[model samples]
Target chain A: MIVVLSGGVGGARFLQGVVQVVPQQQITVISNTGDDREFYGLHVSPDVDIVLYSLAGIVDAANGWGIRDDTYNTMQQLTRYGNEDWFLLGDRDLATHIHRTNLLRQGKTLSEVTDNLRIQLGLDLRVLPMSDQPIATHIQTPAGLLHFEEYLVKHRSADDVQDVVFVGASKAKPAPGVLDAIKQADAILIAPSNPIVSVGTILAVPGIHDALHEASGMVIAISPIVGGAPIKGPADKIMRGLGLEVSAIGVTRCYRDFLDVMIIDEQDAHLTREIEDLGIPVVVTDTIMRDDETKAALARTALQAAGLTI
Target chain B: MIVVLSGGVGGARFLQGVVQVVPQQQITVISNTGDDREFYGLHVSPDVDIVLYSLAGIVDAANGWGIRDDTYNTMQQLTRYGNEDWFLLGDRDLATHIHRTNLLRQGKTLSEVTDNLRIQLGLDLRVLPMSDQPIATHIQTPAGLLHFEEYLVKHRSADDVQDVVFVGASKAKPAPGVLDAIKQADAILIAPSNPIVSVGTILAVPGIHDALHEASGMVIAISPIVGGAPIKGPADKIMRGLGLEVSAIGVTRCYRDFLDVMIIDEQDAHLTREIEDLGIPVVVTDTIMRDDETKAALARTALQAAGLTI
Candidate 1:
């Protein structure tokens, strides 16, 4: 089996490529919960949903989040009720939040709820939450200490990031099957997602980085950055805000301790030597997943870099 | 001010009539909470919503519940998630449940949450849940012990109800404004709602019955029954299941202790003497609220009987 550490939209799109290259049943994804939040009391795991929807081919491709053709009737009602509608929640998408929140309230762990969702969506691969405990990612912006969702969605990531804190993270343990899956996996792939506040928060969970440190297989990550900037999202802005270099080298450093192989985009080919200088092997490729072909090709390259013959 | 003890659909329509005659600001509704149940972890107060929607003139007139032209996108998603979608929840209607559940989780009382919903809906009058604490109405049917909505909505009232119980009744105290509203009301109206589960549950609260008994103004009731059967719903079925007379006399008997006057349909005129014999005054009219005119007429009669000059 192959294990993957994933974040939101970008990660979900990368997983689509991974599934096309790898046997679906052989994959296990540990999705980041740093972006998880409650809107109108519904526990919304934004990353997990994007993964599920993207995998099921039901995601709104244009938006990279929520179900395609979904209605916003509930959001309209919430607006009428004078609740802030900054974070858009579609009616069809609400079922996931509703079911997940309900099951969580009923004492089921996040792993169990995600597995149930996977089965409901007829997915072959498993998607486990990184941890069962609630870990809130609070972003310190000029606007105050805003939740990650507030920074990303509400503020449109316009504010310069001051700091990121994953509350309740110290006590968080990897969800059931997460560590074991990593230990027994033939390869571990980190999706092309934001390094900080995404993969960064996952590593902060007590036992997860330790499990990665001891993984028998190579831990490979595709650079989300192309030409010294993220292909999508506010990764560059956030990294710059946090005083981190905004390039493949910067991303490699985030996972440098446990990373075995780094894949850099063709545009950043000159940075290959610098990435490899960190004592990690580098694979040069066009890492941007522009279409289905590019996504599958990237996945194939990541697997091959981890010594998987495909 | 006038205080109306209410249930679902039928009572909501009656309230529409009430609002037509009485000034909106002069009205306060003590809505039954026994039928309140958690749907997918969201607290859903059916009767209170019905009353609010009806008073705000946004209710589905034909169905007597839900918002007009509402979509079922969320309900469709719930079905896809393999959850039983017996109780239909419109996408717009879900906003109320979601908001209510969130506030309740934040330690807001049902009264406060309801008042907030009232204000959001642009409703002028008060709509208070009968009690701040939860009180579940359970129905023992052939399908075993089912929640009120299950018996009513799921089974479509097909199964024979063996018993109707207001769970948590003993511990329930009247919501903050409930007792006070009734005591200080210029008129107390028991809307044309189910005696066994609707208004019955309100009376089941500790201080509500006594408040009605000591009401400064007339404690009046309009029988939900029009002839030998209720205008809508399983009021007759549940009444028969409990072995009570399913007619005007039966509804009057349900409120006999604190009832000062009862207004019933003309078809049940023969039973007027029977109700009056129990020391309550009676008025005969076409109690069915089929249109704006009928509803307004019924409200006019109830207020006139309460000695309201208007």
Candidate 2:
């Protein structure tokens, strides 16, 4: 089985490629839940929903999040009701939040709710949240600490991030089957997602980092940074604010403790030597996924780097 | 002040007429809350929304409920997620539910939330739920007891209603200002609504019935039944199921205890003398309000019946 650590849009896009190379039944995704927050009292797991929508072929391809052909009628009406309209919630996309919230309130854990949703959406692969307990990614800025979504969406990530705090991470237990999936997997690939708030928050959870280190399979990571910049999102700004190098080498440093191989873009081949100096093998290739062919190729490369035949 | 007891669509239509005759500031609508139910964990008050949307001039006039031009994207997506699709929740109308649910979770009473929504919607008149406590109107059918919405919307009222049950009425207190509005009103008008579930549910509340009976103001009721049938909804069916006559006399009997005057449609003028025998004065008029002018005329007739000169 192949286990993937994923975040939002970029991660979802990467997973689409992984599915093309490997049968979905053999894959298990441990999705980032730090981006989860309550919008109008409905629990919204942004990264998890992106993965679900993308895999189910319902994701809005242009935005890489929310369902395609979704309407914003609910959000528009909510705005009319004087609700804060910073986070846009599309009408069709709201079904996931509403269903998940209802299930959670009924005493089902996030993993159980996700499993039910995946089955309902006709997905065979498993998707688990990093933890069952609420863990919010708060970015400390010069202004004040803002929830990850508020900083990324509401403020457009304009604030300079001084630090990132994973609230409740210390007490949060890995959701059921998350650590088990990592332990039993033939290989684990960390998707190209924001390292600070996405992959970083997952590692902050109590047993998740230990599971990655103790797993018997080769651990591979695809660098989110390409040519010293993130392909999407504010990974570059956040990495810089945290005083980390904004390169493939910086990504390697973040996962150096458990990472066995690092996949970097061909544009960052020059940094291979620095990445390898951290005792992680570096694979250089064209990682920019512009189409299905390229995405499939990138997934194959990451899998092969983890010692998978396919 | 003119306090109007209301249910859903028919009552909302009557309220539109009430507003045309009386200034909005002088109106207080006590809407039924027993039709309120949770859909995917979101509190949906169908009756309350109808009154609000109608008075704000944003109602879908064709349907008598929901906002104009509302979409059902959310309900469609929710059905895809394996949710029961019996109750139709429009996308734009979902905003009121989301906002109200969020505020209720934040410890605000239903009345407080209604006030906030009213102000946001630019409404001047006070719109109060019958009670702040949860009270669901259930129809005891031959098959089994079903929620009012289920009986009406889901099953299309196919089963014979043995009786109507207000689940929380005995213990539920009238929402703040409900009884006070009745006691302090210059006149009270019962809108043409479903007496069994809408206005009936409001009156079933603990103190609301007594307040109407004890209030010094004249109480007037416009028959929801015109000739021997309701203008809309399953009022006649439910009334017959509960063993009540499906005519103006049956409606007069429902409110006979507190009713000082009865307003019947021109079609029901033949029953006016029999209605007067119950010690209630009768007024005949063309109660089918097809336009604003007709609605204004109906409102004037009801007000004048309460000894108010238009």
Candidate 3:
């Protein structure tokens, strides 16, 4: 099994690349649930769905989230109900959340519900939540601590982060098969997701970081940050808030203890020596995957960095 | 205030009449919840939604249920997951169920959630579920006991029902304002709905029957059966399952104790003497409301039976 540690859009896009280079059944994704929230009573798993849609080849390439060509009739109606429409939920995407929420209400764990959705979406790769338990991400800002979604979506991530908290993570147990996938993997790749709230929150779940630390297989992570900024999202501002430089070297420092290899974009080739100084192997390549071909090529490079052929 | 006891399609149509005849704020509907079930963990309240759609004038006129022009794309996709599509939930209708299910999971009672939906739907009339508790109508057939929707929708009521069980009725409490509506009503009219499942289930709720029986206002019922058959739905077969004749006289006899007046179809005028013989006043008219004009005329006749002038 090739287990991938993932977040939302960035991670989902990278997982799409990985799938292109590997058999569906050979992959397992341990997704971050920190961005998950209950809106109007529906459980919204932003990261899991992004990955699911991306892997299924139905993600909106232009927006990098939601289904392609999905209508917004439901969201428009929800707005008529006086619902805040800052976070856009397409009609087709609403169905997935509805199904997930319904299953969760029936007492099915997130893992089981996700499995059902994957099967329904005709996806073969296993997508597992980092933990079955609720782990909400909160950002302490000038406006007070807001839920991660509120900061990222409702506020458009315009607020500066003062502090971050992974609520419920202290007691959350990893979802079933997550630890096993990491332990039995030929290699584990941390996708180019936001390190602070995405991959960081996944590692916060009890026994997960430990499992990676003790993994028998090689662990490689592509830097979400390239040169001195995030390729996408608010990772740079968030990293700066945490008093860290936004660069490949900074990303390597975060995962240095567990990651065996760190990959950086060719633009950050000058920082290769600094990343290698962390005592982790370095792989320099053009890591920005703009299309399917490039994504698969990046995936191949990451696997090769772990001493495996695609 | 005018309180109408209702079921689904026939009931929604009748509610359209009642709302047309009376001021919206003065109309309150106590909808049957016996057909309510958790479909995929969604608190599916078919009767409440029908009444809501009808009162809002957005009901699918052809089906007499669901939102007008609603699509079934989500339900069609649900089939790919091997889900049985016996319950035909339209995409727009699915949004309502999804929202309701999510709220219920968040610990909101059915009554509260229903009120929220009513307001959201822009319905002027008060649409209330008979009770917040589950009071499923189970049909005991030659094959086996089936849920009310399963028998009504899936099998199209083809199975011979041996018995009808209002499961949990004895333990269910009337929804908030239900008994109060009965007490404050100028008159209460039971619509031409399924006697066994709809009106029967409402009376089955612990204190509802007694409240209706003792109310100071006149209690009238429009017979679903005309001549010797139901104008719509399976009330005829269901009444027969309970060993009752499918006639206006039989309907009068079933409700004689609490009924002050019983409205029969013009075709059943010959049986008015028999119904009167049972000591219940009778008003014979065209009880089948096929259109807005007919529905409004039916409402006027029903009100006249209760000695109310429109």
Candidate 4:
């Protein structure tokens, strides 16, 4: 089995390619839950929903998030009720949150709810949250600490990040089957997602990072930064605020502890020697996924980097 | 102040007329809470919303419930998630439930949440739920006892109703202003609603009934039935199932204890003397409210029956 650590839109787009190269049954996704938050009392797992919608072929392709043809009637009404309309919640997308919230309230863990959603959406691949326990990613900014979503979505990530903290990481244990999927996998691929809030939060979970080191399978991560900038999101701004170089090398440093191969874009090939000097192998390639062909090709390169035959 | 005890569509329609006759500020709506239920963990007060939407002039006039131009995207999507779609929750109407649920979770009483909604909707009238505590109306059917919504909305009142029960009524207290509104009103008008579940549920609350009896104001009821049948809903079916006559006399009997006067449709003029024999005065009129003029006229008649000059 192939295990992929993923975040939101970028991670979801990357997985679309991975599915093309590998059979659905052979893949397992350990999705980031730090981006999860309660909206109007409904638990919304942004990252998990993006992956689910993308894989189910229901995601709005243009936005790389939410369901296609979704209506904003609920959001518009919420605005009329004097509610903050910073976070956009589409009508169809609300079903996922409502269902998940109801199940969670009924004593079902996040993993169980995700499994039920996967089955209902007709997905063959397993998708698991990093941890069943609630963990919020908060970005420490010059203004004040803001929930990761407030900084990213509400404030449009305009705030300068001083530090990032995973609120419940210390007490949160990996969800059932998360560590097992990492250990039993033939290879592990980390999608090109925001390193600090997405992949970083997953690694912060105590047993997960240790399991990545002890696993027999090779671990390869596709860098989110291309040509010293994130393909999407505020990865560059956050990395810079945290005093890290905004390059593939900076991303490599974040996961260098357990990550075996670092996949960098051809634009950053010049930094190969610099990344390799950190004791991690560098696989330089064209990592910008513009279409299905390119996404599938990038997935193939990451699989090869993991020592997989196909 | 004029206090109107209400149910859903019928009550809401009657309220529209009441507003036309009396200034909005002088009206207090005591809406039934027994029809309230949680859908996907969101508290949905069907009766309360109807009254709010109607009074705010945003109710779907065609259906007599929900907001105008509301979409069912949320319900359709929930169906895709394997949720029972019998309860049709409109996307725009969901905002009220979402907001109310969030506040209730925060330890705010339903009365407080309702007040917020009323003010946000720009409504000058006071809309109070019958009670702040959880109370559900259940229909004891031949098949089994079902929640009022299930019996009405889901099954379309297909089951034979043996009796109607107000679950949690014993412990439930009237909302902060409910009893006071009833006691302090110049007149208490029972809207043309389902007597068995709508107005009946409100009267089931212990203190509210006593307040109506102890109050010096006249208590008047408008017959929901015309001739031998209700104009809308399954009032006749449920009334007959519970071994009550499906006519104006049956409605008069329901409120006869505290009801000082009743206004019946001209079609039921023959039964006026019979209702009067039960020690209550009767006013027969054209009660079919097809337009604003008719609704206002009906409201004026009820007000006049309570010895009001207008």
Candidate 5:
């Protein structure tokens, strides 16, 4: 079985590749929940939905999140009612939050709700949330502690990030099957997701980091940084905010202890020996996933790196 | 001040006429909340919304409820996720529910939340819910006790109703200002709505019926029955199920206690004397409001009947 650690758009994009190389039923995804927030009082799991929409082949390819051709009629009306519409909830997208919120209010765990979504979406792959516990990834900014989305979406990430804190992760256990997926996987790939908040929050869950530390399979990571910057999102700003280098070297620093293989772009080839000096081997290739071909190629490389495809 | 007790579509249509004669700010609507139900976990106030949309001139005239031209993208997507979509929730209309639910969750009374909607919709009048307390009008059918919506909307009012019940009305207090509105009003108009579930549930609230009984205002009612049938909805079926006559006299029988005058359609003119025999004077007129002029004419007649206009 192949297990993937994911965040939002970037991870969803990389997952498009993973599903191409591996049979869907044999793969499992552990998604970040730190970015989950209530929009209009309905629970919205941004990262999880991104992965779900992407793998189900319904994600807006141009934007890389939300359903394709989704309508914003609800948001338009919400604005008319004087609600804050800065988060941009599409009408079709609102259904996901509604279903999730209803199930959660009915006392179902997040894991169970996610599985319910999986079955409903006709996806064969398993997608486990990082934890059932609510975790707010708060970005300490000049604007004060902003929820990650408020920092990225509402504020447009304009404020300088001062620090990042996973609010509830310290007490959170990994969601059911999360630890087991990592432990029994033939390959555990960390998708090209933001290291600081996305993957970082997942690792912060009490037993997850420890599980990876003793995993029987190889833990591979593809750096989100391409040519010294993220293809999308505020990864570079956040990495720099944490007083870390915004490069392949920095991503490795974040996951070095548990990582068996680190994949970097050809642009960061010179940093290979430097990354390897810490005893973690680095694989250099064209890691920027521009299309289906590039995404599949990257997935093939990650699998081959774990000796699953060789 | 003019106070009108209202239900859903029929009341909304009648209010269109009332607003033509009376300045919006001069009118107070006591809308029934017995039909309120949670659709997909969001609180949906059908009667309240019908009133809001109608007065705002955005109501779907054909359906007599919901905002005109509202999209159904949310409901479409919701059905895709396996949720029952029998009750149509237009995308724009959902914003009202979301906003209402959010405020209600934050501990705002339904009255306050409704006032918020009123102001947000740029309305000048007050639209008070029947009570701050929730009173579900359940239809006890051979099938079981069904939510008013489940009975009317989901089941298409197909089942034979054994009885109708206001589940929580016995303990429900009249909302703040409700008793005062009835006590101090110069005129009280009961819009054409279902007497059994709609107006019946309002009267069932503790103190409200008593307040109406002692009201100093000339309490007027427009019978929804015409030609021995209702203009819309299951009023005829439910009245028959309750073993009451489905005619103008039947409507007067339901409201004979507080009513000083009863307005019946020209088609039911023959029943006027029979209704007036109960000590309630009856006015016969064309009560089917087909257009703006007809609606205005009906409003003028009701006002003149209360000696409030020429």
Candidate 6:
């Protein structure tokens, strides 16, 4: 199994690329559920859904989230019913939430629901959450503690982050097969998702980090940060808030302990020496995934760096 | 306190009149939750939402359910996703399902979420579910068992009803305050809804019928059947399936145990003696709620019969 650790958006995009170049059945995605939140009583797993939709080839390319051509009529009516419209839930997206919620209410685990959804979407790949337990990522900002969605969606990630706390992570165990995916993997790829909130939040769960450290598979991470900026979202701003530089070197240090190979952008070729100085293999390529072809190319390049091109 | 036992459509219209006649806070609606179902995992309580929308004055006048001017864009997309679209769930309706499903996943009771919806919609009336548990009304047809929605919406009630069963009825407990609504009410008016599937299903829940039997309040029912046919839906057909007449007298017998008065349409005034023979008081009026004025007039008439018009 080729297990991939992912956040939302950028990570989902890279996973989509990986699925395109490789056999989907051979791939397994261990998604970060730390950003999960209960909105309007529905379990909204942004990263999990992003990876699912992206891998299913049904993600809205323009937004990098939500189903393609989905309507917002439901969200508009929700506002009329006096609901806060900070989180824009698309109508098609609502179906996924509804199905997941129903199964959960029936006492099924999140892992089971995730698997069923993948099957329903005709996906051959396995998409599992990091944990079935609720692990909420909370951003401690100057305004106060805010749910990750409130920070990312409602406030548009405008606040300065003082600290990031993953609630329930301490009590959370790795979901079934997550550790197995790590142990049996030929390679483990960490997607180019937001480092602090996505990848950092996943590592917050105790056993997941240890599993990565002990896994025999070659572990590689694609740089979400290019030269000194994220391709999308507030990763750059969040990095600065945490008193870290927004560069390939910063990304390398973040994954230094577990990372076997690091992939950076060709624009940041000058930083290769610094990245390699950390005693990790560094690969430089055009890491900006502008389209499906570019994403696939990036995926292929990252795999080659780990000596798994075949 | 004004207590209204309601279904959808006509029940919603009756509740609208009740809201206009009484102080909103004093009115409590014991809405049928037998129509509740998990369509793709969203908890959709059609009757409760209809009453809510009607009370909020946002109900679609044409369809008599969902929000006015709600689009079907989501429904159209659901088809693309290969979902069965026999039941019409508008985009606006999806929001309610999403919100309810999400809330339910977080361990909130159905009653609590419904109250929250009532508050959100600015409805001052207390809308209590008939039962908090999942008690679905299934019709055993020639084709086998079909859900209430499939029998009603999908097939348009064309199937020959061999028998009807309220699944989970034996296990269902009346929602909090449902029994209280019956006992404390000065009067109880059953709206002109499907006697079998709607009102019958609500009464099937344990403790509800017993409470009504012992209630001190004057129990009145507006006949859904008039002349030889139903005002709306296939109540007459269902009545026939139960080996009962498709007239006002048939409805009186169905509710005879606790029924104090039977309200019939002017067209069925001739059936008064036959109903009165059952020892239930009979009133003939324009029971067909053609407009808001007629509905309010019906509410006033029912209140006057119970000596609570003031």
Highest DockQ against the true fold, candidate: 2
Give a tens-digit lDDT track for model 5, residues B1-310. Answer: 8999999998998999999999987899999999998888899999999999988888888888888998998898889889998899898898999889989998999999999999988999889999999999999999999999999988999999889999988888889999999898889999999999888888889998888889888889999988989999999999999999999889999998888899999888788778878888988899989998999999889988888863
lDDT of 3 by residue, B1-310 (tens): 8989999988888878887789888888999989998765567898998888888777888987887887776665556555678888776777677678767777988999889989988877788899999899999999899999999999999999899999999889999999999999989999988887999999999888889899888999999898799878898889889899989877787778799999989998999888888999888888888789999999988888888988
For A17-98, candidate 2 gives per-residue lDDT tens digits of 9999999999999999999999999999999999999999999999999999988999998998888899988999998898
Q: Which scores better on DockQ, 3 or 6? A: 6
Candidate DockQ values, in order, are: 0.83, 0.92, 0.37, 0.87, 0.86, 0.47
Query: Which run of 10 residues does model 6 chain B get worst, by summed lDDT?
Result: B74-83
Answer with 2 or 5, whichever has the higher DockQ. 2
lDDT of 5 by residue, A136-182 (tens): 99999887999999999999989898999999888888899999999
The per-residue C-alpha lDDT of model 2 at residue A284 equals 97
> On DockQ, who's better, 2 or 6?
2
Please report, in order, the local distance difference test score of every candidate based on alpha carbons. 0.90, 0.93, 0.87, 0.93, 0.91, 0.86
lDDT of 3 by residue, A1-310 (tens): 7999999888988887898889999999999999999776678999998988887778888888888988766666566555677888877777777778767777999999999989878989899999999999999999999999999888899999888899999999999999999999989999999988999999999898899999988999999998798988899888889888889888888898799999999999999887777798889898988888889889999889888876
lDDT per residue (tens digit) for residues A116-201 in model 4: 99999999999999999999999999899999999998899999889999999999999999999999999999999999989999
Per-residue lDDT of B131 in model 1: 92
Q: Candidate 3: lDDT of B148?
A: 93
Judged by DockQ cut-offs, the docking class of candidate 2 is high
TM-score against native, each model: 0.96, 0.98, 0.94, 0.98, 0.98, 0.86
Which residue window of length 10 is worst by lDDT in model 3 chain A? Answer: A74-83
Better of 4 and 6 by DockQ: 4
Candidate 6 local lDDT, B1-310, one digit each (tens): 8778889998998877766677887888888888889776678999999998888888888898888888787676556555678878888888888778767777989999999899988878899998889999888899999898889999899999888899999999999999988899988888888888889988898998898899898888998887789877888778888888889888888899999889999999999898999999898898878888988898888887777856
Q: What lDDT is reached at residue B286 by model 1?
A: 90
Worst 10 residues of 3 chain B by lDDT: B74-83
Q: In CAPRI terms, where does candidate 5 land?
A: high
- Candidate 1 lDDT over residue span B139-257, tens digit each: 99887998898888887899998999889998989989788888889999989999989999998999888888888999889999887988889999999999899998988888998
Instruction: Itemize residue pairs with steric clashes in candidate 2.
Output: none
